[model samples]
Target: MKRNFLLLLIFVLVVIAISEGIGFQSIPIGKFNIGLLPLVFAIIITMVLGIRIFRKGIIKKIYSKENVNFASKYLIFIMLPLMARYGADVAPKLKEILSIGWVFLIQEVGNLGTVVLGLPIALLIGLRREAIGATLGIGREGELAYISEKYTLESPEGRGVLSLYIIGTLFGAIFFSIFAPVLLDLGFRVEALAMASGVGSGSMMTAASSTLVARMPELGETIRAYASASQLLTSFLGTFTMVFLAAPLQKFMYGLFIRGEK
Candidate 1:
């Protein structure tokens, strides 16, 4: 154990303290507003501090293996309360979600859009077989597990998924927080966007819906309920998409990308 655990704790406290101090600011440009949330800055600042460009120093010691692993291990536990609160939002609007229940299920097929849309981009950018893992449904926990088990982490596919997973972990929330509000400003419907926010990831859903709530406080509970329900369905359906849809699409595209098959 480190001699001064409080130093790390105090550093995080100060970062959050300063982040909250800035709060949420909306910058105006023409007719649209650019929103800045404190959590956005907090994430950026923490990521910058943890960057290994410094190599060895107090930053390295502060972000020790023990400390980092502890945070990683307990992140799910920390989100439990937030998930419970979102669950409450869903209960009141259960009937609304039920009305569109078929829409959500049908949209589960849309998960294959990942392979459809991204495989070509990945190949055009000069990725090899690694494109199989990278474009196979957002590179989240389930995709990683499936890739690792089917292909093993020692393979190139494993490396591809891991690389995308790390990137998603770092910036997905930031992108969602900004992207959701911008889309609404561009005249998208809140309910549709809320349902789409549930793109199979809890943190991303929360980030997107929070912006929606900030912009439309009157519909905050409804947004949360829609987002929470969508996220549950996306997560549940993603596995089937991966096995049935993603695999075949990847095979066909890989042949086109690598084998020049007609």
Candidate 2:
């Protein structure tokens, strides 16, 4: 166990070192600037290295299923407390969110637009139940929990949500990082973007806020605070939307459009 932790720590340090070395590189696209961070680069490096090592069959036991599982569990154990602390940090900021007035409410509603947009697209693409499930869900752990509980893990809906969850987990952050800055260049306010970033996923929020902060460092704390507050709002209300609104809306759309049912 100690050896595994030591290895993990070493890997973390290496990634951080590599990230810091190359973190300052930024790309200018027209009037918009895109920034990169060591954290993002570190993640990419770790993935590449892990794949190479795996393919080479080097240190196979270190990458064994049991070890991987243990590491995953350990990460969750560490993460949960941190997440709780983050929630607490954001709690005082709830009044700030409310102070934003109707904009905050509208943004919160817009956060669930995925379900609104996704269901029709899924039906148009000729997706059935499971695919619809995946498409309508926002591809997060909370959505996964709801889908799994309501539909069971082995159901088509479960499979759909799970597929989305995996895809979102892997790519959502990168997508946010790349696009948020571009959107800002396109004339969106940082506060609006920050609220948008909160769409019920911590990673996505982090990526989006990071991009904004990188581009506009002066507003870093404010951007993060708004984003975090928006995320907390989403976390609390997203479940209700999914259970009461999104689910039914998806079913109604699917049945009406695809199944041609009255």
Best by TM-score: 1
Compared with the true structure, the alpha-carbon lDDT of candidate 2 equals 0.73
Candidate 1: C-alpha lDDT: 0.84
Best by lDDT: 1
The residue-by-residue lDDT of candidate 2 on 48-109, one tens digit each, is: 66574463443444555666777766766755764575576566666776777577666656
The TM-score, computed over Cα atoms with residue i paired to residue i, of candidate 1 is 0.91
* TM-score, predicted candidate 2 vs. hidden true structure: 0.86
At residue 26, give the lDDT of candidate 2: 72
Deviating ranges (above 4 Å) for candidate 2: 1-5, 50-54, 59-62, 80-96, 260-262
Cα RMSD for candidate 1?
A: 2.3
